[model samples]
Target: MTTRFDPRKALLALSAPVLAILVAVIVTSLILVVAGDPVGEVWSTILSVPRPRVVVSIINASIVYYISAVAVAIGFRMNLFNIGVDGQYRIAAFAAAVVAGEGWLPGPLNILLGLLVAMLAGGIWAGIAGLLKVYRGVSEVISTIMLNAIATILVAFLLRKVAFRTEGSNIISTTPLPEDSRVPGMAIIPDVSREVYGLLFLAVVVGFFYWFILGKTRFGFDLRATGRSETAAVASGVKVKRMVLMSMVLSGVVAGLVGMPLLFGQDHAYGSTFQPGLGFAGIAIALLGRNHPIGIIFAALLWGFLEQQSNALQITAGVSDRLVLIIQGVIVLSVVIAYEVIRRANVRFEQRKVAQALEEQESMTKEGAPA
Candidate 1:
């Protein structure tokens, strides 16, 4: 019984990312046409390597997606839906920014402390949902959703009350951190045409860590086992309760880190204007990528590309960025469908194999009985 490596499953996994990019392109083109902008310019924005700034923007977007995708994928692996990543990120970003904006601490140390605080903030925020699901037997989907709202309102309130200030006499909700606290540019790669390259290293590390946690660690085993079957896992003596809580916390920490680039690297502080939908975007990325670390990287990259070119759609094709969300919805729907198809096929294959084995054993027994 020689079994060949199945490429079909790989193809299925690849389909979502490919379809997402295609949808993005098509929508952008339509927008361009409607807006009286040349669709060619929009396409060029995405494909053409112009100056280093566009390249830098591309890199920044990619890093954000990669980081956030992994954060989403962690809860997915543990079978705990952590949908409040956006709120978690927002809260954490605010925490990091406030701490760094003081200019009261040294550069490297301040940055380190800022990130640590951000992680803690995100973990605590997510822990609420975890606690609800674990002890109260509440639905995580519901709890996380509500928690997102709560987190958003709370962060908004804090910015107004606690951090209700900005540099140079502005009435902004938050103060911008000094440049010294930001991640240094990629000094090693000169002429790379991008200043915000520190995150490239972070993205690489994130990928490796993601794969390692899911593929190498014992904790990963517990998470996967629980995800595969909670009943079986509990019977096998796995601490389902603890696993759920820890996984959610860890997932939130990763989500919190997503703000580093924006809060610390770019903006130097959290702002009310910063988009929170990135967390939702992370979910789309996780699903499209099949919750695999490597798959998430490509999915994130594709999403980043779509978003970057969205501006072009508005200018060149006269399309709106809202079209990007529509395209994302289509891609997500297709990915879900693909997943179901693959799951059903695998179940059928297993059933057939078991039936064949049982029949073979019966036939052998009858023959040996001398009939």
Candidate 2:
């Protein structure tokens, strides 16, 4: 069935993010003024055209961020806050590292096997929280928070005690994967020393699948229904509990890929230097993107650009790199407030339309009756 589009509704939908961004800019500028910093210089530094290498770095970073955000967005869509995405990706990357380090299979097969192991590890870790929520009536937020700590400790222990230590290195790390197993980097940009991660394609594929599953399939419909109202979904014959479990697992499966771009394309091993907190960052990006696949890509790129600018801000503008963090926080808060305001406005508009329709119906009936 073709759905009729409302231009006014579309305009309202577009306005929220734009309003949020404008508010963030104003707030950030005010903070800069209060701090006695050169607001214009900071803004100029942030908006300055980056070098080719920096551009490549931004793209590579955005790829990882996009994948991570997509993972979080999946859980968000189901109204499930999978806070343990950070932990899931960490543990999964560690497992993938160990498997790839083994080099038990031939080149391509070994890489594929490691990827599969990562997905399984992530799914299992996230499934624990899902199980508790479904069967034990536990709050997923609390359970996942605890799971994050547990996963951190577990990964540390495994790294310290079980992982093969690289000789003469100060940092502890799993055995590095064989050269053949490492994914090749793509020279997508000219005159750039750094190459884009080959796994950029993976992010594209994940986005495509996320959009297709959530927008075009029966399972997606049921999942969304369950998210909106479990009782209503149950009345509609959707198995809410099963959807809960599946959604969490599916979210984690994507989470497992959070580190692949870094792992396969650069690090080639999980180590002390492996970046943390990406899963948490994904939450912010997911919110900024409104949990839409396409929106998440732009949000991730914006995040990546800000991150890349942090260094330049420090060197050129002499501004604290932490300013980026403040900006990010402000943007998220603004977006949340804007969306809430828009939601209330939409509700009032609908109510007014309904009231008007009812009044007109009553007037028509009275006119038809004998005076």
Candidate 3:
């Protein structure tokens, strides 16, 4: 039997983002007015985007954000909260940088080794939370949060004790990766001075795999089933503990990529100046995207655009860049509320449709028997 198209459900899904954006825009405009900023001017500056350089920067930034968000999304799909992504990627990058700096192999081999080190470091870090959850009955949420703090301390200690190296101007950083280990940037935009990240393709590949594995694989079915109802999944003979562990590790593997674009394409080393808070940002992005790989890409790009706009806002409107933070926070909150509301409405609509169909069938049966 063929299933009919669900326009109402489709509309409801689309409305979540649209309505949330509308609410955020309205609220942000009011705040801008109170702060003596011209809403129109601010938006104009943001939308103008200035130059090809700025566009390239946004795309590059979005690639990193995409990796981070997808990592968080993997955990989200399995009802696991891997808050330790921050720590996972930091340590992973540091270790990978240290290994890559050795430069003991051919260019391709060196790059592969660096990536392997990153994945191992991140997976091991995330596995700690998974182990605690499966064997010790600890909540992954609590364990992961604690692990984040521990990771910060551990990274600092390692940086000082082992990986410390002074670079130009006495900047503290891990040993810089050799040229052979670095991923070259792509000159995707013709005549643009800025080069797009080579690792952007990696993010796209990860997204494709995420969508395929989750939608078309048996493990994906078990993972989704367990997420929906653990008891039912257990009764169906799905291995809950193993699934949980696998999901967390898979999330960490992706989290390892979060630092690669910046590491290979720009920084070439892990340093004190490395960007932090991306893991937290990933959580917000994942929620905004509803944990779908394709959705996460758009969410990441939107976030990157907002971040890039902050500079324009600062220069053109003479507004504090912090205004972008307020906008982001409002957007995230509104999106969450909007999705929840839409979900409930959709559930009701489905229930009503089923009830009506049942009633119609019952009436038809009764008329045929009596007449």
Candidate 4:
């Protein structure tokens, strides 16, 4: 059947971003005005990361951030919040780093071993929450939060007792992986200090797999159905508990990679100074993207840009770093409101169209009088 054109629906879809941007701009500008800062100038500074080096840095950062966001998105698709992704990845990376440091075989083999270890660690960690939810009726959120704290303490103890190594630079870290196992960066632009991360290819592969699984696979359908309504999905013959377990494991698998881009490509070791809070940032990005792979990429990029712009904001506009936080919060709130309004409008439009079709059919029936 041919579908009717939905002008209101189309307009609402486009207006969401527009409205969000307008709100964010107004709010941020007002904040700047109150602080006696030139609003236009501050905005200009935020947008000044168009330079080649800055752009490369943003891209590099986005690679890791995109993986982190995708990990979060997987859980969101199943209506589960895997909040312990930070703990999962950190512990996984540490364990992977220790394994990679033990040069047992050749370059490729060692790297493969490290990746496998990371995935195993993350999956085991997340599986605990899944198991608890299925068997004990515990909430995943509460269990995952507790698991994060446990993971942090466990890693700290391991680093001190088992995996610790003193580098020449006086930085205590997990033993470094061999150079041969490290992913080499691509110097895409000449005379630039930054090199595009070798793990960018890994991110692309992950994005493709995420799209394929969600858009094409049967498990994807069941996962989505469960998310929509667990009781209905269970009645439909879907094993909801099994789906939950599998989804959490899969989410953890992706979360395992969140640290690899930095671990294999940049740091080559897990240290006390390794970047944290990526999993939390992933939560925000996944929400912003609404759990689509392509959407997550753009969301991650925007988030990375904002993070990268913080330096420029401080240097050029003399603004506090907290301003970025304010803008981000406003944008997220605005988008959520816009989407809700659009959802209600679309529902009303669909109802009206159905009623009109029914009325037209009744009128046609009445005109065919048999008198």
- Best candidate, lDDT-wise? 2
User: Cα deviation of 158 in candidate 3 (Å)?
Assistant: 1.3
Name the runs in model 4 displaced over 4 angstroms: 1-11, 163-170
Would you estimate the TM-scores of all the predictions? 0.84, 0.95, 0.96, 0.93
Error of 1 at 176 (Å): 3.1
Ranking by TM-score: 3, 2, 4, 1
Least well predicted 10-residue stretch by lDDT in candidate 1: 42-51
**Candidate 3 per-residue lDDT over residues 200-262, each given as its tens digit:** 888988899889988889998998889888999999999999999999999998898789888
Model 3 scores worst on lDDT over the 10 consecutive residues at 161-170
> lDDT of all predictions, in order shown?
0.78, 0.91, 0.88, 0.85
Q: Tell me the tens digit of each residue's lDDT in model 4 across 1-371.
A: 67899786667766876687689889999988988987987889887746778778888888988888888888889999889898889888988988898878689899889989998988888899999988898888999889989988888888877556574655678878898999889898777888989878889988999999987899899999998899999999999999999999998888888899888889998888889888888887877776878778888888888878876777777888778888888888888887788788888988999999999999999999686
Model 2 CA RMSD to the hidden true structure, in angstroms: 1.7
lDDT of 2 by residue, 262-361 (tens): 9999999998899999999899999888898888888899899989988888787788999999988998999999989999999999999999999999
TM accuracy, model 3: 0.96
Clashes of 1: 6
Which wins on TM-score, candidate 1 or candidate 3?
A: 3
